[model samples]
Target: MKFKIPDRRRLLIAASLLLSSAAHADDAARAQAAVTDLGTQLRSALMARVKAEGPVAAINFCHDQAPTIAADVAQKHGLRIGRTGLRTRSPGNAPADWQRVVLADFETQAQAGSAPQTLRYSSSEGLPEGIALRYMQGIATEAPCLACHGQTLAEPVALAIKAHYPEDAATGFREGQLRGAFWVEVSSGN
Candidate 1:
């Protein structure tokens, strides 16, 4: 049978679909790149703090810096930014919106005996129309980190941690265990 010519309406619909998909892909890529850049800066700042002060200081610095850096990057890119720490127990069965990408990377790095430096992507479960990106780095199990994040918190560090976070659960870490995960979330409106 002879093939019929395509109509204008059908051609337009196909073109629209192609463009929408391409736009989504582009948005995801751009969001990833923005987060990567911000993460690099945050890492550099945290490392500097660690070198200047100590691991506890670095953790404190990161705690303050992560959100600021993420917000700045998101604002610059005209996107929303958010982050969450991975839990010891997978929240897969929990009602809360758990971030699995960061947790997986942290677990992989913990098993490999290396600091995690990978950034992964995922989409929101509640808002499936958006894209999410995350990055995890090993918090060096140094003496300072052990103070608060260590199995036995040092007096001074413990006091400081208590003062800052009275109900903190980010502790009881070993010298080489994954202390916690750092994350960045971006919505692509896809």
Candidate 2:
């Protein structure tokens, strides 16, 4: 009877762990989806803003509205979402300590001819002694990004960017380069 009881308890524990793992995976997937949707929203908005207000205005839109949009999305999804870059146009775009490490790794991989669009990473990190899901997707520089971030910027656009971001370092990018990444972090309700 005693042996049977222990066996049953062990089975219950194993089942609980399996269920927990599944739930963690679901949460991670939700976080990734939220980040993708948020990135689309921000990119689309910036594109429209640039079309209506021009590349100059697009820079301003990024400086002014991008954070707000990210914050809103994060709040809605119950996750932390944002972008970070190797050479940040806005100092605000500077990656956190962990993100800096990832960005450098990404830069190295990209230099080795990895498809920037296909570059991504996800991991579960111990947080508060529990596990949390973290994800990052590379932002490849495309033709549309050149107006402000290209190898050569228009004189006026450069001036506007300088006026706005006195410490701007996010430029001199070529098409297909790694501009940065959109990241999402969500706590597993463990």
Candidate 3:
């Protein structure tokens, strides 16, 4: 089918929109990578510790080393990064308002058969308290994850968790269910 050539103004506006969209997409990809990389490093560390030491050591790593890893990654990436869950073990893992919305959407999507690794999130604004580019991906519970985040824990595991996190609520998750999300953010002006 033959089509009329677009007018100059219309063509300019279309180009602008396309470019904006592409830029946002690029930013989203970068954000996803940062969060994924950080999570990967932390998970590997925890898994190695679990295999070598045990659940108690893994729990301690989650309580200690994990935060250090997150902070280091955030510093390296120059972004705000963290993990949050609906039922959090550490108070630091509490979801912000925007994170709550994203987590709820993740739950709904997961219930409808969306795999956690396939979940994607990106927004240039709408952060809970500030303007930022936000990305979050759900974390599904896996076999290794169960050593610390399982539905039922061994007595020693429970004691270790209690000793570390007195108000832990980040358990009772079944394998393949959403354990939480890894999120990354940067100021919109960045």
Candidate 4:
């Protein structure tokens, strides 16, 4: 005896699968957009701070100001934002996945001698297996970025860093080194 599946049942299964995938994709896109917008605002504020103050001051300002900026934006948008940095060596000498990604992108741009810029990424590995995760660009170096993140750290820069973060291990950066990256999280209400 042979058995056959009903055509209506097959169609229903196919439609459900398609709908699920489409929903997942939409959520991911929304998360990406939210993080991208946050990155834009953060960069703008950082640039303005740098222009007003020197590199060391800019770094300090960012350290002081970024949290508030992120919090305000996240609260308004109903999202979460986290920041991390790239350094010559990872904290506790452990490998940092986020740093690795930023470094790779920074190296590619450096090899081509282009100005460093923001990079973005998305993932859906965790969180209900369908929710999208997003991160925004965090370039390692720029012309002005050198004072705080350069081949050789300036005296003032070193002092400032020590003052702010005594246990900070973020140093020994080259012109195009990946010094840090930002991670922003968003929830797609889908």
Candidate 1 lDDT by residue in tens digits, 1-190: 9876579878998999898667656666666666567657766887788789976676577656666777788788666544344433122212124445556666676678675334344443344445443223333445544555667766776776666566566667666665544444455543
lDDT of 4 by residue, 52-71 (tens): 87768776786677667878
Model 3 per-residue lDDT tens digits across residues 1-190 = 9886779978999999898787678778778878878988987898798889988988887887888899999888778899998899999889998889999999999989988767877887445565457888899888878867888899999999999889999888888898889888876656
**lDDT (Cα, tens digit) per residue for candidate 2, span 48-138:** 9988989888877788898899999988898888988989877877898878888898999999999787788777746444447777888
TM-score of each: 0.60, 0.88, 0.88, 0.68
Which has the higher TM-score value, candidate number 2 or candidate number 4? 2
Task: Return the lDDT, model 2, position 107.
Answer: 91
Candidates sorted by lDDT, best first:
3, 2, 4, 1
**How are the candidates ranked when ordered by TM-score, highest leading?**
3, 2, 4, 1
Evaluate model 3: give its lDDT. Answer: 0.85
Residue pairs of candidate 2 with colliding backbone atoms = none
After superposition, which runs of candidate 4 have C-alpha atoms over 4 Å from their true positions?
Answer: 1-5, 86-120, 126-140, 188-190
Cα lDDT for residue 107, candidate 1: 65
Provide the lowest-lDDT 10-residue window in model 4.
86-95
Clashes of 2: 0
